[model samples]
Target: MKPNKHSIDFGKEEQYLNSDKFVDQIICGDCYQVLKEMPDNFIDLVITSPPYFQQREYGGGGLGNEDNIDDYINNLATIFQQCVRVIKKTGTIVFNLGDKYLDGNLLLVPYRFAVEVQKRNPVKLINELTWIKINPTPKQNPKKLIPSTEPFFIFSKTDNYYFNKDAFLEYHDKCLNNGRKKVGNEIGKKYFELIDRSILSDEEKALARKELNETIVDVHQGKIESFRMKIRGLHALPYGGQAGGRLSQIKNKGFTIIKIYGNSMRKDIIESNVETIKGNIHPAVYPEFIVQELLKLLTKEDDIVLDPFLGSGTTAAVAQRLRRKYLGIEIHPEFVEHAKNRIRQNINNHTLDIFI
Candidate 1:
């Protein structure tokens, strides 16, 4: 059975880390202590943005408040190892780390931790996805550029990690319609002209026209947003450098068409407005949309999603909305209440459909 909607500050060690009794609970304690109680292979996804070194005042002197750079990276690496231990072999971890400036030089803190995590843990570095902040905090220093991006490192113990690619593309298909090319009424006109001009037999031209008509029908049905038909002698080779069956298809068929649903070319970068709040208990509250995207990409309904850093409980709220079980661990007491309230409000105010 699913746990209650509200967050729970874990206490009484006897009842802790029990997935059935507290599947969606937020354990309000040091993650180091909380992670120790979690069972191996318990979580399917661990997506969280931990405290960056000296960036914010995350109470309880957690990983970020260390005295030096090495200490900070070491502390985060320790958390990374623990998270890997709790996650299943098929699980995936997405840890977003922000960079900092020290002594007028940009400290590569995020990369440092990533290197250390790979060195100490038995995991593979899958992707270093960059997050471009649309509205970053204004910096008054004229000599340095404004800091606006962060890195989300995807790690997994094995290649069997669960990734929902169709669900991911479906979201960007809806979210990136404005950025995609238009499927105009004269979409297939140019292809027809190119086919007529190409050096092909009448039989080849007939085949190309048939395929072009089918492709345009797909655009009208919203199966795809656009297409590119490469007719022999009329256009360059689609696969000049790549080795695939596509090269032979152009040699034998005289034409080939590429279908793009929408935003299929956009990869490895996330863009969202910085969620800057005034007098907030948790200083840095990440954008909820980013969490939603990651959850959709990495998990399915009823899968366990863990956030060791928890912060203001963005993961828990998104997990609940997506019908995934969540386990959150936070250090501060006041932020625990803030996270619980946020999750409660999200559940009460909005209803979300499961991943299609």
Candidate 2:
């Protein structure tokens, strides 16, 4: 799909506004107004970690108010409403959120956002994944337990969205040994013929010869050595007894060939390892890994990704790295500057270019 020219120009405008001589630069401004200037259905994904209500003092138009959680929900819903309008029909929205504490009670902030988002009726709830933090910060709470984990809420604009499942497959063809056996005998004979005719390189012949031996060994281990004589025509030596026995045992353990295709579906949400950031812009800043995953799963190349309340520009940086156009709104100038610098550094590293 072609990217919207307007959005591309807007990204260029950000680069020019910064006057940093860097392409695809981050803009320092409020995301809502910036997003309003952008055309609708331009973004492929909206993956963001917004500030939790009254969590910390972000200095400029930050998340505030302890008296009314309902008001917070309403404000969040308004931001998401704008997000829904700009996001493409095939796009996805992932909110990495958590709960808050109020009067010794755990406030269901993530759930509240979920309920409010559902009221829009245009988007569908995909999954509520639990981001299990392997090593969480220890805290002493006299009345209740310290919070350790957070919620990553996945939402989609339509039932049919962009998800490349095979992109995350763990196994590769190099991990497969069974299929190599069937072709070994034929390949070995061809190799010997080519070597005798001086039509193949020594390295090529050696690799083919080794494959032939491994195939014979595999057949013997599988107890299907009826064609051993055919394979023996290549005059290959028997594999080392101990090593062959170990290979047989390894094969017996069952070589699982996990074929990950483009249609692979993942229902589980991945977690990011907690790491410290340089600045204390906010108490909770999401890891770049989490944002990168969302961008890969939800958006397409050159598609716009919006982040209202972009705390530290984790979303923007990830989006830029993945070649997706991004709009990040931050009320705090310091955070905006931090996010802009982070993106500028990424651009200098050539990690934020769409063409790259």
Candidate 3:
């Protein structure tokens, strides 16, 4: 069937989304039909987990349950082509795709989709994240490794995308001294041994010992704080002091630990327990933590977020809770009602104070 197109009235794509009709609304229609009507460069971020191949039959005659792998990839390419047009130049698209099996043979669906989508669209795959579900369903056969990880492929419309690196900060209480003896024990012994071995005057030896003691005290009491590791010419340890010299540099040389405010450096692996929401009949619902993490990285306040396969309304509810505008499209009427009810309960019970 040919997609029914609707007229877009606003002069520019940016102005088109300013109208109230599209924001914070869920449209019950086919994803292709709804996506074709949207103006170009209108959506700020796109986050969705499209149905896997031969996974589910959602009462909509579409690509998820296609037996042929080539047909499945082709159908997904068409949907993402529309997504590339709708997303802004500085926007990002995060797709969480899972693996499937055909006749007991494992099909690498996520990697194939990533490669095929890039061929059809101008988007580039920037980051590949692994969602390690702690409580995934156990397979009856114990021959293979337990299925615990899923892939999240992050794509950007342009070379420079809008990413908020500081939004997802993880606070950890790290000890000041690690993998070393306490102050005045191991360091003091090493300093005295150095002073005795060196061919220097007594005064010089005393001065060196005093400086080393002061440095150790300063570091042990948390007087200094280390940030990120600077990629220097040599393999140096992380040091928090403001001192500079050949000795100081040599002292801070082997594997050092640094403290960065944000956890962007370690975001490639996500560890979360699988979520089980009461009354949610959708078998493949994403946890709220996953959506929240993606939103923090990709969107800002009032930015428009779109979910083409709005299963159980996890994305919309999380987007609303984060103060961003959202638009959801679900093809099945039963899922449309399911998503609406879930969004309503989320707004009423969780985000009521924020909206008011």
Candidate 1 residues 1-356, lDDT tens each?
11222112233243335454447888877786678777788899999999887887665545676667786786677778889998889899999999888999888998998988999999999988888899999989999889999999999989999887766546657666655566678889988988888898999999999999999998877677788877777676765566265667688998888887555554888888887656457778887778888888889899999998998888898898988998898877788888898778767978684332
Top-lDDT structure, candidate number: 1
Name the better of 1 and 2 by TM-score.
1
Report the C-alpha lDDT of model 2 over 1-356, residue by residue, as the tens digit. Answer: 12322111213323213332222445555555555555677677777777676676566643444347776676567667777787778877777776877787778899988987898758888877777676677777776666778888878888888876544321222233344355343534653564455434555446545654665555545433323221222333335755464344323421111112221235474545775777545566887766665566566787777777777788888788888777777767788788888888888898652220
Give the C-alpha miss distance for residue 155 in model 1, angstroms: 1.3
In terms of lDDT, the poorest run of 10 residues in model 1 is 1-10
- The lDDT of model 1 is 0.80
Runs in model 3 lying further than 4 Å from the true structure: 1-20, 169-264, 352-356
Name the lDDT of candidate 3. Answer: 0.72
Root-mean-square deviation of candidate 3? 8.1
* Steric clash pairs (candidate 3): none
Q: What lDDT does candidate 2 reach at residue 244?
A: 65
Shift in Å, residue 56, candidate 3? 2.1
Tens digit per residue, CA lDDT, model 3, 107-174: 89999999999887888999998998989889886667778999989999999899886454222213
What TM-score quantifies how close candidate 1 is to the native fold? Answer: 0.84
